[model samples]
Target: MWMNEKIKASEVELTGLNGEDIGIVPTREALAMARKLKVDLVCTSLMSSPPPCRLVAAADAKKEAQAAKAKSSDRVVKVKEIRLTPNIEEHDLDTKKQQAARILQAGNAVMLVVRVQGKEGAAAKVLLEDLVRELKEWGRAKTGIQVSGKQAAVQIDPVA
Candidate 1:
């Protein structure tokens, strides 16, 4: 993120004000060019032998960063967790299903976790699979039932 005179490279790979490549030039020359164009000589890449720098206005750079941040924020995907027991009653299962439906409709995924102990392990797997089937209209199972020693889990993603 070196800017202007702070750029220590003897020669930098420069880009012009309108983003055209200006090839490699001495740091001093690049700084002079930036001053002539009334823009910042911003070092964009440091990994190369000659660091790459771009000419950009401070306001334009700030705006570009803000736009990228907003774009990334807009893509944030949320996953809601719903916990259940192997022996969940019918009414409770319906309520949990409804909650998952709401979360899916809101563009979020749902993770169903069914806790079990010993003999209840198989039941937990079945419960997870059954719930996935019932939720097919709202979301599809992104992952099949994964049964660990004491629990089974599945992720349901919203239908696109």
Candidate 2:
């Protein structure tokens, strides 16, 4: 059956095995060529006027399309967090940084939050900046690290 959209009145456009155009061949001819190539005739791209179709192996076309979908999905973002105190211990900071690194390496954004205790809140930025800088080194270029306002925070997501 012909497509509902208007097309230049002709036999039919068919693409060959190597993706070459074998323009306006009879439908039967196109089918025969597909069988000769041991492939199926597939419509590959949109053509407003002609609605171009291609003759490719059915299995190969499906696999290629699926792979494309998976590749795109892999880029989807995920978020993770890490928390610290303004007066955090040096060793504990190292441990926390390592944990954040692991999260970022696994393809997630890390939000680093620093909580200030008592008088530590006023001087929190000094420590928070240090901690953010150190944690950022773990992610390198793969993750984005941001510090939320007010140093008295208790949350940092790894998948920033």
lDDT tens readout by residue for model 2, 1-160: 1221222333457777676777766555666676787776655444543446567676876786687778877766566656777777888978977877787767676666676555666566666556556655444333333334554432333433
lDDT tens readout by residue for model 1, 15-94: 98787998999999999998897888888778997999999997886776677678877866699999999999999999
- What C-alpha lDDT values do all the predictions have? 0.89, 0.59
Error of 2 at 27 (Å): 9.3
Please name the candidate that would achieve the greatest TM-score relative to the true structure.
Answer: 1
| Worst ten in a row by lDDT for model 1 | 68-77
